[model samples]
Target chain A: MDSMMMGAMTQSMKSMPDMAAMDMSVLQACMDACAACEQACTVCSTQMMDCSPACMNCADMAGTMMRSMLRMQGMTAASMMAMLDACIAMCQTCMDECMQHADHSDACRMCAQACKDCMDACMAVKDMMMASA
Target chain B: MDSMMMGAMTQSMKSMPDMAAMDMSVLQACMDACAACEQACTVCSTQMMDCSPACMNCADMAGTMMRSMLRMQGMTAASMMAMLDACIAMCQTCMDECMQHADHSDACRMCAQACKDCMDACMAVKDMMMASA
Candidate 1:
């Protein structure tokens, strides 16, 4: 996300007690990873391989996860954790599916890497939440 | 989604035993509703009202719900149920928030209606799933 949008989101989040002390840089990195994963999975899905369905699932989950973070007012910490878990599961599924064809498909390789990055980023956010809690 | 994309999704889904008896029309209606809701919510969020965060959350959930339907191979019945419930909850939250400003904002009014339609569509899909199960 751009600084302006991030600023706006931060400003909005200040009103939510659960989100008031959020680490902006960590949140930003996770959002960026989700965006990248969404894009990569979207491109990979177009390849129409067996992994397409998983890629589409991952793309959508990543997008929703990113948006939910931006919309902190709409989320409770438990819901946020559930969403993060779902996203991580989707990313893992997509990564495994894409890895099977990575040797032959550049798109799949990139998508798998993106999913890995997104999963790692999501885990970071989860860790931060746990530490704070 | 367009007919061609729907057809492709249908074709891909044929390989999934759990989705073999799925009703295409019901899924299509739900997807269309989700798409409309996503568009409406996206537009409404730009208004920068207190409801903007809820609108954004609803939009993302609607989009993910739609895409997940298109990629049935990636979803188990349990996960699908969970997602539908989440989508319905999000739509309800967004609609409630938007409805509060419906008397003044045309955008909020439209977004609330879109959310309502999306929630109904999601419920219909859930009903179909339960009946089939």
Candidate 2:
């Protein structure tokens, strides 16, 4: 997610037809959101609460989402849409679970925020996909 | 992937409709493969080969595919199939690139093997999904 790596990723993504006309910033934001959400969710999952299962699921999904952005070539329009739907579902579930304990846990609060951000970013990608399609 | 964590994950998974009848062994094997392939792909990515992009991509797709399994609440039959296709595409691309230098690098060979195993495991999941569907 550093500037150099981001630059490298952008340079690589320019080759894709659908992405060629899309803004790199949107992709970058989604990736950043994913990384942040993954970290937050990971920390939260270690809490071992009733919400832990959802947290663990969210953490893994966010990590996967981040990596998918990092490797866009392997993603097609359909896969991307499916992934976005999955991520959104995961973030919603995680956020709801985390919110139950967010009042007592800073990690859960931060995780909820990260999940929200990730959901927003994923929605953005979905919108872009729709527009392009 | 620990016994405790795996146990928790397994217990959570048993609640899913399609997964309720699955041989947990098959899912466990697939998860283990995904974890191993993710690690291998992550390490392989740092090598920055012509394969690096594919490595990075495959690693992410594998991670996503694994996490989706973890978050079964968020996945449907179609999403799972799309994910398997993407993971297979990624591993194929990564293995092809890595094989170019497999004669000189153990990591590449190991990576190729991991990719192969992941692909096989993913295909197994796909086959299972088809049968279940």
Q: Pick the candidate with the highest TM-score.
A: 1
Instruction: Give one digit per residue, the lDDT tens place, for model 2 in A52-114.
Output: 767777777778778777777645566567667767777887898788888988888998999
Per-residue lDDT tens digits for candidate 1, residues A4-88, read: 9889988978888887888988999999999999999999999965898888898888988887887789776766776777788
lDDT (CA) per prediction = 0.87, 0.78
TM-score of 1: 0.77
DockQ of each: 0.34, 0.23
Off by over 4 Å in 1: A1-9, A46-48, A71-82, A103-106, A127-133, B1-9, B46-48, B73-82, B130-133
Clashes of 1: 0
Instruction: Tally clashing residue pairs in candidate 2.
Output: 0
Name the candidate that leads on DockQ: 1
In candidate 2, stretches whose alpha carbon ends up further than 4 angstroms from where it belongs are A1-9, A15-18, A67-86, A99-110, B1-18, B39-48, B63-86, B92-113, B129-133
